[model samples]
Target chain A: MTSGIRPKRDEETVIAGSCDSENPRRVDGLQLLGEYRGAAYEEPRFLVYRPDGQAVLLTPLLYRVLTHLDGRHSLASVAERVSADHDRAIGPDGVRYLVEQKLEPLGLAVLGAPVEQVPTADPLLSLSARGVLFPARMVRTIARLFAPLHLPAVVAATLGTLLALDLWMFTSGQADAAIRTTVGDPAAMLVGVGLLLVSTLFHECGHAAGCHYGGARPGAIGVGLYVVFPVFYTNVTDAYRLNRAGRLRTDLGGIYFNAVFIVVLGCAYLTSGYAPLLAAAVLVHGQIIQQLMPTLRMDGYYIVADLVGVPNLFGLIGPIVAGLARRGRRGGRHAWRAEINLRPFARRVVIAWVLLVIPFLAGGLAVMLLRAPTYIGIAWRSTAERWTAVEQAFTHGQVATILIDTFATLMLWLPWVGLGFLLARVLQRAVRAGIRAVNRRR
Target chain B: MVEDMTVLEREHVEFLPSREALGGLVNVNIVVPVNLAIAVLGSAALACQNAVGIIR
Candidate 1:
């Protein structure tokens, strides 16, 4: 049945003595079904009829909003009522807008004033929330640049050369002066920091471009924190929706981009002998170390996930932990149980997770425990440092100076243990899943 | 005939096996096409690393 639009009428569609001015209304009428303690009406009582014959089964409070909207009470009064009732500082315009947006489409709500975008509902993952957060805008920008690169062997060879050369320099002790010099110069430091930021942006673009190549739309990119470490994330969630081949492209996108960028950076280093290139090289080297760290939620971890055909290794950890918990509860019940109930592949995988997690978790805990005081002290000092920087900037009118310095500091420390843990958990699951596949085959 | 066709269609769409489904009924967990791409990448990364002399 097609519901056509109905004309608006300017009258208070009042419920007969059902509404109380003292009390509030809920939007959902079914919730208020029991609240009408003394109200009486025919079947389907307390319905405030809209102009289009679409009746809103209002709770007493909602009906008040409708009753007050007589084109006489200003929208402000309505907003205040809603705010008082809902505990949200919903503006008069917001309430009307929300009601209007819902009603106009259904031909139930009539316009009293213009509608605007409502206040954002508080999100679970705040901009501050730690872990794998990607902003959509940055991801889109990245995708545009990422789409042109081909999977040329030369690109890989070039990247390989850069990494080897950097490692060679560090091992040979020839790069120490270069590193020290780059760190000492503020102008050099800024360039190094800028290049690192650009590389990260390129990394996310890799993921987006990979998704595009794989027939998926790359979504939003944003800043997210992995525990205390802040990261830039692009929403390539659509990549997961694609086939395993497509998913791999998305996973490798960042590294592929990194490889190409390093070649360019390396060439610049070779040509100019600039101290900034050395700094950039060091920063790029650090990024490579991070992405290759298979134990964390880095690019390497996602590559493993895609290889293992796991949609979300991180999400699977909770269920795996729960299963372990249940096993612990069973305790000795299975002491003499059939040892070979699971397929060989599944058993091998279970063993792998246990083997991987036990030492990793223990080692991680030990490291945390050992460094806890120092880390805490550093964090406190860092916080103090940030505030100091901000205050000094403000007092001296050098906000840009402080901000640039702060961003540089974040790049240095962002890919530490926090990201390691995230990636570790992901890798553990991927490895276990792979083992499970092998066992199933047997 | 129509009922038989509907039953086949339902089975085709129902990809995953139930926890209660027998092991023999389980199809081989074939590595999807994308997984192959990732393997290629992993090898590529390793190959790139080798070429660059990260590993001798």
Candidate 2:
């Protein structure tokens, strides 16, 4: 009954022979966060981490091994216990190999090794640019305050209220009336924009609250500039420690809060006869749909990812493709199995996602690139029109029109601007990768 | 717990590296640009209203 340990296999981390380290210390901030018995996960997994750093999973036996790496325990000591527990003959050399090759490389253990970040080949469509809005400490405090809102009874009540509101808004002709009132009145339009922003911020809080409710600590809240648009985010990266239900809750929490906001907006509209509030309620439904766009790093993207039990779907593309190539070259056997370490169910889901995603994003980006001139000209013309509208509003002294048109003009051209930034970033990564590949070739 | 007496028992507990289930640096984010969505949707609605003489 010997325990075997290996890092999640990737191109960078190769299985190597026995190592030479005699003593390895756990990194200063490293921690073993305990076992994950989340029912949603296909297997029992262990969690280890450093606050605000990477979260690594380990096997049960490997979790045991990590527990012994206090720098005081000799390689022979760990090997002896593991050998006894595993009922196998693992020598000190074997222990050293596990520590040096597996743990140290992942920033878990160190033996005077220079700390280096593991290189991740992020997917082409990943949202890599981000900045924090609220620090971890503050978000944690705020999230805890909102935790009660997710209590089972409260969640049920909120959902019921949301459902009832939707029914009334559509059936009672409130939604149509609200939209007309909002669009025709310039001030209502500007207020609708403001409400959407506020609702988005509220949505981030939902994620934080969900994480807190799930017995996991949430980090900061922030915004990330995903390829072309600003996306509000709450760093619920800590949610990995939770079970499948908990993780899913974190993923769906944003939209759930949107529901809550809608309910509040509906109530306010009914109470005060506020047209703009009702307008916000209506426009927010669009935000909900947009959030659910299955592509990109949106809430929908994460929902799919959590459902499949895969974190980075894009990262698996290279390995899965390589596995396919190997299958083709090696008589089409179970060679792909060696490439992906997922359970069969998750593996299939991930593969299907890769199939659909690659062409969709590639084709979409291709069209965007190919027709760049036409799109840019259109954007420029639209912006100019809105600008002219703003000038006309000023001449007529229509403050509401000026405000609403001004907001629309700014938003109208941002997506095209985002495309430009996306191109620059992708180029930077490709150039960096190219340089590295060239150096490796030498 | 080293009393695992057989390979079958050991098979279940072999320690291996785990893959994180979240994406990117911050895991998940709501990528919908509220400002943009409301802008486009509002513009189209207003344009329709103008055509039908509501905004005038």
Candidate 3:
């Protein structure tokens, strides 16, 4: 046999050969996070944490081979060790096959190299804002301080407060008045908007706190544009190392924090009889409801994903749809099956989620597109009026008016900017499709 | 004689990966139909409101 690794035709088996002694296959810095027993799946799985905050699940057999890759052992030696330990004849070829097919794809195994450079522009990185704010260490410190609030008693108290606020709103008849007053007064609207912004920041902190509580390291907390709307996101990807319950807690933590903020606002409304505070509380409730929408990559989507033990439910949608189309064309009676990394039950749940989400998303997008021009025009006019007011306030040396006008301008221009972004995205997709068609013809 | 032979056969059996059957009944069968019902009812209600001029 030649003393070099060669790719085999069969996916399950590789051609057994002597590996190079000088350049041994090694697992660089892959952290093995023990085993995870998912409720949906029969087999126990383990997680491999990558340097770039991505986690990959592996079967026990693959994990055993991973433990043997310590930079010193050749592929042959590693296979021998696994065979000795497990009493199964997993030859060097099998080891190489697993490493190349599984581990290498996840960036866990390094073959014939000590270090691999991180990609400068990962597709996921584009979804997030540039640069990190609140590094891991800082997040950990803040999380430690808020750890006490995550206790059972504190959680119960927060839930009680929410119930009380709901009861009060039902009885007092002030809810409608608060909404009307806030809508009528620009100043009140601005105050409510400001409160909403602050509450969103608090919501992100809650996610970080939940991650810490679950014994996972929360990375940066930053602001970025999700589609057109600016949103706060905490890097709680490490929560995948946690069990399903812990992951769910992390997903729901943001909404929990929003509830806490609402309670505080409710108390303020009760004390000062401030209509704007109550209005802001109502707005926060609306925000929580919106976040619970599972159609998008929001908290509810993550919650469902964790519940079903599927990491990338959205990614599976395209394949599932394509498979369905193919099956229909072939006149198959049964639903088309694809190799999505999900259990039977979880797969069913994902299909249901996709079916519900598709129509809702399509309808929402259709409505938005139909009304875009009118909405855009209104936003433009409002922003111009606000800007003119701002200039007048500035010329008159009225600092307070200028601040209010600036806030108003921001509020007005945001919708316009969002519509523009949506238009641009649609056009880009259309252009790409046209280019593909042209290439096909050529 | 038969028991002794069965035991020997069991000892030499090879372990194979489990191939669980993908059952016919899925959660989507129930959920998708129910969601469709809701959508139909909701659109009907909206149409009624619009006809009555209660909604613009």
Task: Enumerate the candidates' DockQ scores in order.
Answer: 0.02, 0.11, 0.03
- Residue A66 deviation, candidate 1, in Å? 40
Model 1, docking class: incorrect
Q: How accurate locally is residue A295 in candidate 3, as Cα lDDT from 0 to 100?
A: 63
Candidate 2, residue A271: the lDDT equals 96
Q: TM-score for each prediction?
A: 0.48, 0.81, 0.73
Q: Which pairs clash (backbone N, Cα, C closer than 3 Å) in model 3?
A: none
Ranking by DockQ: 2, 3, 1
Question: Tens digits of per-residue lDDT for model 1 on A1-442?
Answer: 0111122233332211222332222222211112211112111113332221222333333444555454444557766765565433556655455444443233233453321221111111112333433454655665665675744565557667867876766786646766667555444655666777788777777778878777766876556554324566666654534666776777777777777776677667778888777666665655755675444455665666555543333433434444555575555325312221223443345446545655654575566556656644554455455555556556766544455446533432443444455456556656866987999999
Worst 10 residues of 1 chain A by lDDT: A117-126
Model 3: share of native contacts present?
Answer: 0.00
lDDT of 2 by residue, A46-154 (tens): 7776432556566555666677777777878877777676544566766666665566655567665544454222344544456778898999898888888888898
Give the winner by DockQ: 2
Residue B38 lDDT in candidate 2: 40
Colliding residue pairs in candidate 2: A1-A86, A2-A86, A38-A243, A85-B2, A311-B21
Candidate 3 lDDT, A199-283, residue by residue in tens: 8777877888888898988877765544444456677877777888787878888889888898999999999998989987887
What TM-score does chain B get in every candidate? 0.33, 0.38, 0.38
